[model samples]
Target: MSTLNPYCPDCGAAVAHPHAEGCGVARCLFTGGRRLSCGSRHRADLELDHACGGDEWTGRWPGEAEAAEFGWWTCWDGPGPEQGWDYQGQGWVQVPEGTPGAVPDLDRLSTDAQWDRHALRWVRRVNR
Candidate 1:
């Protein structure tokens, strides 16, 4: 058998076992949610309520349509360490920039080096 431990659903922080009963409310160290979950991969049924008394902040991903509507550059495809654009297999390759729905200039680069260089340039331009 496996033992279930409670953890913050938002940040994945561990929660005290004593506070795991009843409503199963656990404060998140990061997001500070009143409800949390266990740090178990098998346990996916968890709910988190923010103590700040407002709508939960649903984080947006890069290239999401919603992010684009808000004029937010959530989409980032570049050759950087923090941007997750580092070389994966075929060396640094250019990924589509801007939001997912937005059209990209397919004629930007021809080779891998060109793609990487252009992608990095584009990311820098948009980020600034």
Candidate 2:
């Protein structure tokens, strides 16, 4: 087995430590792409409270439009059937709990594919 490097190759920051500003390898939580700053790089507000204010992307997620445009249904915060921006409907939709596409319990997801499918199907938030 290969050992993992504990330091960031671009900024020399230790693993689990925040990367230096503008570090190339820093991963963006919103898109899983490149992090633009030490702060959360979101399209909605541009910056989150901090890097670790709940890793799940909020309903104000930057990727929502792009995901809908590309037909990527997955949501970072697990919208379930209760709330989400429906691409087909072209409006934010909400449903009662226990709806057909309601997010399954986390423990029920036993595989990576299952987890991915769950994320892809759900959305976030409930107005009620």
Question: Which lDDT value does model 2 have at 93?
Answer: 30
TM-score each candidate. 0.18, 0.30
Query: What is the clash count for each candidate, in the order shown?
Result: 3, 4
Cα lDDT computed for each candidate against the true fold: 0.30, 0.39
lDDT by residue (tens digit), candidate 1, 35-82: 334332333453333232222222211112222333333223455575
What shift in Å separates residue 74 of candidate 2 from its native position after superposition? 25
Writing each residue's lDDT as its tens digit, candidate 2 over 30-90 gives: 3343465434543455444544211222222323333333232322334345445452442
Q: In candidate 2, which residue ranges exceed 4 Å CA deviation? A: 37-128
- Candidate that would win on lDDT: 2
Candidate 2 weakest ten by summed lDDT: 107-116
